[model samples]
Target: MDTKSLIIEKATILFQQKGYKSVGLTEILKACNVTKGALYHHFPNGKEQLLIACLQVLNEVIMTDIESIFRRHLSTKEALLSIIDKLIRDLETEGTITGYTFSSIVSEMATVSEPVRHACSALYENIQQIYSAKLVTDGLSNESASAIALLMTASIEGAMMLCLTQQSSDPLKTIAKLLPKLLKDI
Candidate 1:
């Protein structure tokens, strides 16, 4: 990776593990093994700028995964259940999930930083949009698809948190079971 990409990659992992507020630029610099000048040379706005880049990459990676899952399955229900099952498996093996750094970052620094708030909101909106599109493809109306996608977004993220906190993947596993049942009607 180039210097700029290296900085962003390191910052992204730190933000995902430690959250936005908990991580400092010094730590990011150390993680990247780059000096403040090098970091600032790429991100003049410093930590917040690096954070926005991370969020952008996060959104891209997450949407790609979701789109791929939706494409692989014939029904929205199957895709969703598969998605949740993957999350459950990841949590069970790794004890933490990837492509979900925004949950903590948004809750941590949304009020304190406008860029952070905007980036996080964009990621969330994109997630819902992808889910809604998949539901629509599965024969639901736009209105119903949008509503159901919103519910799935909120529930899945919340369940991920519960899984993390409870140190059990039960919440996501429960979601995996329940979401398919709910989507069966749609």
Candidate 2:
């Protein structure tokens, strides 16, 4: 990667592992193996700007993955369950689950950083929009689809949080197994 991309890439991982407020620029610089001048050259405004960039990168990656997941499954319910199952599998294979990027940063920086909060919100809105679109394709009305997407988002995030806190993948696995039954009425 180029210098600017390298800076953003390293900063993204740092922000993901540690919250926006907890990671210092010095640590980012050291992690990137670049100097302060290089960082400032890439991010003129500094850590907050870098944090925003990291959020944007994560937002792109996550939304793109969600869109792909939706495209792969013809049934909206199957698509949603497949996503939950993937979360469970990922937790098992990786042996750890960090909370979602938007949740982690928003919890830490929402009150302090308007731009960061907006970026986080936009990321979630985009994901929900994708889910709603897929549900519409599955024959649900727009309003109901949107509401159901919101519930799925909350449930998935909560399951991830449980997995991370409990240090076990059982919570996610259980959610995956039970989600189809929960969605049967919808």
Candidates in order have lDDT scores of: 0.87, 0.80
Which residue pairs show collisions in model 2?
none
Q: For residues 109-152, write the lDDT of model 1, one tens digit per residue.
A: 89999888998899889989989998998899999999999999
Off by over 4 Å in 1: none
Model 1 pairs in collision: none
- In candidate 2, position 16 carries an lDDT of 69
Could you tally the backbone clashes for each prediction?
Answer: 0, 0
- Supply the global lDDT for candidate 1: 0.87
The parts of candidate 2 lying over 4 Å away from their true place are 98-100
Using alpha carbons, what is the TM-score of model 1?
Answer: 0.96
Per-residue lDDT of 19-71 in model 2, one digit per residue for the tens?
78889989988988999999999889999888888888888888888888989
RMSD of each: 1.1, 1.7
Clashes of 2: 0
All candidates' TM-scores? 0.96, 0.92
